[model samples]
Target chain A: DVKVTQSSRYLVKRTGEKVFLECVQDMDHENMFWYRQDPGLGLRLIYFSYDVKMKEKGDIPEGYSVSREKKERFSLILESASTNQTSMYLCASRRQGPEQYFGPGTRLTVT
Target chain B: DQQVKQNSPSLSVQEGRISILNCDYTNSMFDYFLWYKKYPAEGPTFLISISSIKDKNEDGRFTVFLNKSAKHLSLHIVPSQPGDSAVYFCAANIIQTGANNLFFGTGTRLTVIP
Candidate 1:
């Protein structure tokens, strides 16, 4: 079974505070992705990693960054949290196919 | 620019009735289409998918229909159950030789009243 897990189910942060979201997948997949889900905007990709220590920006990657030091772990960092950054953050991992398995997701509230 | 669109914000249907969700895409290069179901506070799960080469695919109660000429697709759920209530999202992918990326629509909230 493909199992993906996240660090937190819910979090709260103040403005300018740095926030980190962690994700780990049990399967040794080659691709990982980060996305933010808003009410009207749906799920927009933030960044993706094809391999360890390799990363690429997605459609909405302006205020966020990602780290993939190991094949099993992927991290998303928010440089400075803002109210606009409050949303549901989802982590996904995919093999060489079209199906991407996702974690439970973290709901971040920036105040 | 929104490549994919789900115009309906919400839909309500009664139990045992068929629920139809629609989606449209602007880019003709998208050859693969997918639909996902997401409950509150949980990540979306893969529901079903169809390739551009085919017009329809069905899995039990879930079926997906695609129209290449109209650049549109729809998901039909027969005898909708209360447990099926959730947000549905439509996605399309650009199939490359060894790489693929998905573009998503806004989503439609489906309420199945018992």
Candidate 2:
């Protein structure tokens, strides 16, 4: 089975603090993605990596960055968490197909 | 702007009835469509998908119908049980890109009363 796991199910951070969200996929997929789900806004992409050491910015990449040192793992870094950045973060991986498998998602609250 | 849109924010249906969820897209280049189901605090799961070449696709109780001319699509869940209650999201992508990128619409929350 293709399993995607996230580092945290819930997190609390103060303003201006750096936060890191980790995602690991067991299926050795080539593409990984980061997205934030907000009410009314839906799921907006933040970043995606096609391969190790290669990344591309998605529609909403501001205030966020991603790293893919290994094919099985992807990390999303928030330079400085803000109150407006509080939301559920989702990670996904796909293998040369239109369907992308997603992680359970991390719900972050910035105060 | 959102390329894909789910105008309905929520829908309620009784058990053993058909639940139809609608979605629309403004882009004509999208060649593939998919539907995902997400529960609270969990990731969205792939439910069904359809290619542009076909007008309809079905799997068991789930069926997806596409209207290319209207740039619209619908998902029909027959005999929807309470277990089907969740958020349903419809997504689209251009198969030619091969980038695994998808444009998702604002999801519609489904509530099935048993």
| TM-score of every model versus the real structure | 0.98, 0.99
Candidate 1 C-alpha lDDT tens digits along A54-110? 998999999999999999999999999999999999999999878888999999999
**DockQ of each model against the real complex?**
0.79, 0.87
Candidate 1 Cα outliers beyond 4 Å, as residue runs: none
Over A33-86, each residue of candidate 2 has an lDDT whose tens digit, in order, gives 999999988899999999999999999999998899999999999999999999
State the weakest 10-residue window (summed lDDT) of model 1 chain A.
Answer: A93-102
**How do the candidates score on chain B by TM-score?**
0.97, 0.98
For residues B3-112, write the lDDT of model 2, one tens digit per residue.
Answer: 99999999999999999999999999999999999999999999999999999999999999999999999999998999999999999999987746899999999999
Q: Model 2: how far is A21 from its true place, Å?
A: 0.4
Model 2: residues with Cα > 4 Å off, grouped in runs? none
Note each model's CA RMSD in angstroms.
Answer: 0.9, 0.6
